[model samples]
Target chain A: MQFPSLEYLIFFPLAVAAWYAAAPRLRWAVLIGAGAAFLALASPTHFAFAFVLSLVNYFAGLALERWAETRKALWVLLATLAFDVGVLGLFKYGNAVLAGFAQLEALFGVAAPPRVLSLVLPLGISYYSFQLIGYLLEVYWGRQPAARHLGHFAATILFFPKLVAGPIERPHHFLAQLAAPKPFDPADVTAGLKLLGWGLFKKCVIADRIAFVIGPIFGHPRDFSGLPLAAAIALYTVQVYCDFSGYTDVALGSARVLGLELAPNFNHPFSARSVTDFWRRWHISLSSWTNDYIYRPLSMVISFHTSWRRVGTVFSILVTFGVLGLWHGATWNFVLFGLLHGAAVSVEALTSRARTRLLGRLPARVADRLNNVVTVVFYSLSCVLFRANSISDALYILGHAFVGIGHAAPIGAKRMFGRQYHILLLGLVFGALVLGRWWTRRRPVAARPTWQRWPVYYAVIAAIVILGLFQVNQFVYVQF
Target chain B: MTPEAILLEVNKVFAEVFGNPSITVGPTTTAKDVPEWDSLNHTALIAAVEKHFQIKFSLREVMRFQNVGDMCALVRAKTGG
Candidate 1:
């Protein structure tokens, strides 16, 4: 069952009960059962693929540990990378590869090959593959010893709360908990429930609500431009943030309820002052994963004590981002989105000294303020590619986003913004999230009296009932 | 090299890598202490430190380093403190 689904709403409590009721040594079995049940319900027919991959990674980790002290381990490491990356490439990008060959044939005026291939990327292939790779790398590097228990490894990988999409749980974080399972704690459950409520509000009251407004525009981006397109850019930035972050909160909250902690995946990313800062703040798990595994290794290899070192470093940035973008989908648009970000980050890096000297001339506070606004606006603009149907559509939208900005607001823009009730719903929820968080930070909500808690809780529940777009829409990140 | 002597050399390495001549690094100083001390510059910083000390760090040794203190400790160990 997916997070926020009615089925999940029923399934969760039963799983919790079964988990706590199980004997201490049998907890792993209980978790695996729960995880398998979840996969069956979520992707009944295709669930075995993920389970198989998990087993493959389990063996890979053991092999790496066996050769941990010898260079022969490098062969195992290479084999693991090849196997994991090969499987992902075959399933996830096989179609795109075929399409490329067909286009090449067409270029020489040969008859394009008839293509009869269909592949549904195994659920969470991109995510689990990375986890497996990370796990193997840690073992090979001697940072983490290989897991002796197969059941613990399997449960960690198949953990239903994070399997579909992920905060990309590390072996250390998830598996360590399995070894020293926590007793059922009421406090953790309460905190987890609170997190779930916040996630629900974000999804139903905000993300899904805005999805409707921007759907038609991105669907046929060339239909209109000017303020409507500009507004779409702004709205979409919000839409994706709410959708992805909303899903992560639910995932983390669910894990917490089970007495495990998942690393946070977001941190008010829009507040970042630069593209590098933005990457660090947004999708923290993915960004940090790439930083450690992709960027660090590449940059280290590329950098030498020569003038070309910087050029090689910048090239790594481009390639890493290109790969990051492609990881979203095997499409040109995602590549562009990643490179756009990579380019910005590269420029920021190359100009660090000049930028520092230039900014030093201005008031430090004002310079910081200006950078924040500039970063958000630039990111919003780049998201045109993230949401657009194709490269041409995104470019068209960008070309005309500000074409008639000084003129009166266009009718389409007016109508989109004039969804008064929806706007009100968005505003209310956004205010509640921001202000409630602020207030809670100053004064903890749980410490407050029952009289106060009941009303606030009722208002939230009523808001969900009244404002929620109740349906079984998958989270945005689930597509990746 | 003593730990204190190693820290002074490491501080010089940071200054050269980040181009912040006034930079100072203490035992407790983590990457968070300097905004410029991000992943992008981290490799260069490591290379510079290794060059200055004529010592090499393995991938594991590099990954395990948490702060300036860890780097200094490794440097002292390698340079026979």
Candidate 2:
């Protein structure tokens, strides 16, 4: 069941009770059992697959450590990489592969019977696969020891809270806590509940509500143009951030309530000053993962081995982002999304020194303000590419959003907002929350929390139930 | 070479690569501390170090370097002078 669902609401409390009641030594088993049941309830095939993966990687991490720096180390690393990446790639790209075959058969005028090959990619496959690879690499590098307890290792990756979507646990981070689960603390619960409440505010109250308003405009971009299209595109950026980061907060909060801390997945991404800085803040776990495991190694090797180091760095940026984009989906739009960011960051890198010197002449605050606006606008438009159904649709929305330049259309505005003026007020409050995020994160959610602020929390949680548009859609990142 | 001695060598390489002769790095000096050099030029700096020391570092060694101290230790171990 989804984190915000009624079933999960009932299940979470009972699981938390069972967790604390269980003996400390058996806590790992309790987590794994709960996670297994959760995944099995969602899809038994996925549960079985995740169980097998956890077992394989548990042994793989151990074996790699045992044979570290030997030829055997290479073999173990390659084997696990093959297994994890192979299966992940098969499901992740399975539809794209079938689509290619269908196109080829059409070209040849051969009747390919109904093009029925499809694979259901398990939820969090990309997340866990990356985590597994990172875990093995860390053990292989001696950054951390291979986890000794099989149950703890499984629990670390498959914990029910993170099993479906993730903050993508690092072995050194999550495994340490699982190895020695913390004693029960009311502070953890308070902090967790606070995050849970705010996340629901963002998800149910803002993102889901907005998704309905913009549904048809995105569903068929060809239908409308000008302001309606432009507005929908802008709203999409807000919707997605709320949906995904909202999902992350719930995941992290749930884990916190259970007496473990998961790594945070987002910062105030909109506060970033550059495209590069934007990546540093957005989907922080995934960005850092790609940086540490993919980008750095690839760029370093390319720079070290090649005569053209600068060229290699650019190439690596493109390739790394291409992989990042492809990771989102096998669609051309996603590919463009990755390359667009990659290329933008590359331009920023190459011109940064000169740009810094040029901007130095300007007042520092002006330069800072300019950078923030430029960065936000870049990602805001990129949101058009990300949410569109296909590349052509994205291009159409982008081309036509400003086409009818001087025309004022109240009817278009009416259909777009559609008597949901209150939602606009909610958006304003969310904007305030986003503006105060730096403050909120720093002070509240600490040990026991600030009791004075409890009412605000209660109001948000209460508002979610009262005003939230439930069942609007699944969390946008859930399928990924 | 001792790690301390290698740290001196690394300091020189940092100055040359970053083109800032005044730069001096302690054990705790990280990429953040060296404002002139960030992750963008990190590999280039590393390549300079490899050339100066006349020793190659594995990808694992590159990934593990957290600070100037880690770089010095790796250099000392690699050069074995």
Off by over 4 Å in 1: A304-307, A405-421, A427-447, B2-4, B20-30, B56-61, B64-81
Where is model 2 more than 4 Å wrong at Cα? Answer: A105-111, A404-452, B35-37
Displacement of residue A32 (Cα, Å) in model 1 is 1.3
Worst 10 residues of 1 chain A by lDDT: A406-415
What fnat does each of the candidate structures reach? 0.36, 0.64
lDDT of 2 at A371: 96
Clashing pairs in 1: none
Question: Across residues A355-376, which tens digit of lDDT does each residue of candidate 1 receive?
Answer: 8799989998999988899999
Please name the candidate that would achieve the greatest TM-score relative to the true structure.
2
Q: All models, DockQ values?
A: 0.47, 0.72
TM-score of chain B of 2: 0.94
lDDT of 1 by residue, B1-81 (tens): 888889998999898888789998899999889977988889889888888999887776787777899889999999888
Q: Give residue A435's error in model 2 in angstroms.
A: 10
Q: Lowest-lDDT window of 10 residues in candidate 2 chain A?
A: A405-414
